[model samples]
Target: MGQVRDQRGDHIRDQSDDQSPDESTRKETSMQDSILQEGINEVIGTTHLNAAPMGIILRGGRHTLALFKRSHTAANIVGDGWFVANLIHDPVIYVESAFGDLPDDAFTTEIIDGTPMHRLAAAEAWVAFRAEVIGESSEAYSILLTPIKEEVLVRSIRPVNRGFNAIIEAAVHATRYIMNHDPELEWLIRHHLALARKCGGEREKEAAGMVERFIGEDSL
Candidate 1:
């Protein structure tokens, strides 16, 4: 087996020769797909288990997150050098975590590669990784997460719902709008809210309401 250094100059094994036929086929299929996948994810870091909804970018073989400067996620990852990215399908989780901390019941502790880490109890999948800050700007820290352990906790088939997707989109914009109070972001939030109301189920409608409440209805 060969070895390569990551952005942090840490030696990482090249697993190309160790893969079985199934794993090799999966790798080929993944490479054929779009290299970038963006989604809202729950990130848990710090010993206190600080949780937040953040945008996760999966490009090539690395998972990356752009942590806003001064945010708890940035501070925790910098201090501890590790965190977990959780795949959460619930819009309520996104809206609540985006605004503030989630309740204690929302989290559960599990050992990943012999290290205890906090993860979302409702996560469909979770990846525990070491954070290597590859770059930084005045606004945010660019981090490359090297996965040490990953697991899919649940697998279920569900049809796509536009309303649910709209809620996710609104929550993403709302997270930024609350910080800058940008009028354009506010419009996007309301636009998604409308779609959620028109097409979503009760849960989507409730989640949209939470977003509106957090962003303040007076401005709308």
Candidate 2:
């Protein structure tokens, strides 16, 4: 039931004592995402979600990093012992791009359950992402991530609160999700993607497939 607010008064995760990035890093990240969003719109013709914002989800133990299939990225990036998650706040999604290289604009603003969420950029995050992924830091890939219903195979969709590890039901946190299906989330998803092309959780699940494949068994 603990909730925190951003400057815009959006309910994000509770503020932790961890040291936050400096102001310069924050501003630069915003600039990057804005520019990226523009490019995405132009390429996709104003409808940005034709492809969900792709992200790298970091995980521990048996699994490693994750991304959407259309992203055209490899799973080997997990070798980069570090992790940089992207937090998105839109009507439907609330994902965290666990790796820095995944792309921005995935972390911008949108109305969700009547609240607004702004963008969160990753500057030093990119540096960290490259170091670990290219560094070949570990065979299993040592990085940080969280747990949720989607786990790591969300692909293209951005994450919510990077610090908030799970997709909590509205009653659990006064946000979204109730009885496993969120009406607002459903509507928002429909808004982003055209149902004609591919639709619904069944399709998303089918697209996501097995997390282990993304983890590295099939090896991208």
Candidate 3:
């Protein structure tokens, strides 16, 4: 009886070991599927009419040109050609506004052209632009805009490092602007900076540190 029980236990253990790889693979696949499905659902659920499209021109070095077209959707920008989308909550009028008619061969016209990833890139670009703008602003405006700016910054830092840099740069610019205009807002900016440093991941934390250093020592 003892021998039979031991053999049964060994057999059960062997079965479990054999199934482990398959189980793990299934779990991984399921997770990936969930993520993909969630992304699809988000795109579907989003309302596109409220947001505006921005022409994303990617220029490499001096001559390489990649033009990506995207539109603001649900506080982010969705590119027509990529998988990841950009999260630009407060888009500038200049970026969002159309100056001239779109080109005849513009990618925005077709739904099947760009991927969700391209949209994500556009969003990141917008964030970077915002960061640069904000980093040059006055202290008072930074204070007034802190809540919105910080919200955008947090979102920007989550997915891509480039996006994180954009948000940080923008925040730094805004801080500098505020310090130049209203020195009193520096204290508030510092407080917010501390909060941002504590909230994000490693990259975000690094960004927060950079922002704090830039703003803290900024001459303006």
The candidate that wins on lDDT is 1
Q: How do the residues 1-220 of candidate 1 rate in per-residue lDDT, one tens digit apiece?
A: 0111011111222233332335453343232322125542334332247776655566454566676656777777888777777776777776677666678888888776566788888887777776656667666677766666677778878689999889878877876676578899889999999999998998888899888887775355
**Which pairs in model 1 have colliding backbones?**
none
Tell how far residue 146 is off in model 1, in angstroms: 0.5
Residue 112 accuracy (lDDT) in model 2:
26
Give me candidate 2's TM-score against the actual structure: 0.20
Q: Please, what is the whole-model Cα lDDT of each candidate in the order they appear?
A: 0.65, 0.24, 0.26
Off by over 4 Å in 2: 1-81, 85-125, 129-179, 195-220
Taking all chains together, the TM-score of candidate 3 against the true structure is: 0.27
Stretches of candidate 1 exceeding 4 Å from the true structure: 1-48, 217-220
Ranking by TM-score: 1, 3, 2
RMSD of each: 10.1, 17.5, 23.0
Model 3 worst lDDT window (10 residues): 1-10
User: Using Cα atoms with residue i matched to residue i, what is each candidate's TM-score against the true structure?
Assistant: 0.76, 0.20, 0.27
Report residue 131 deviation for candidate 3 (angstroms): 21
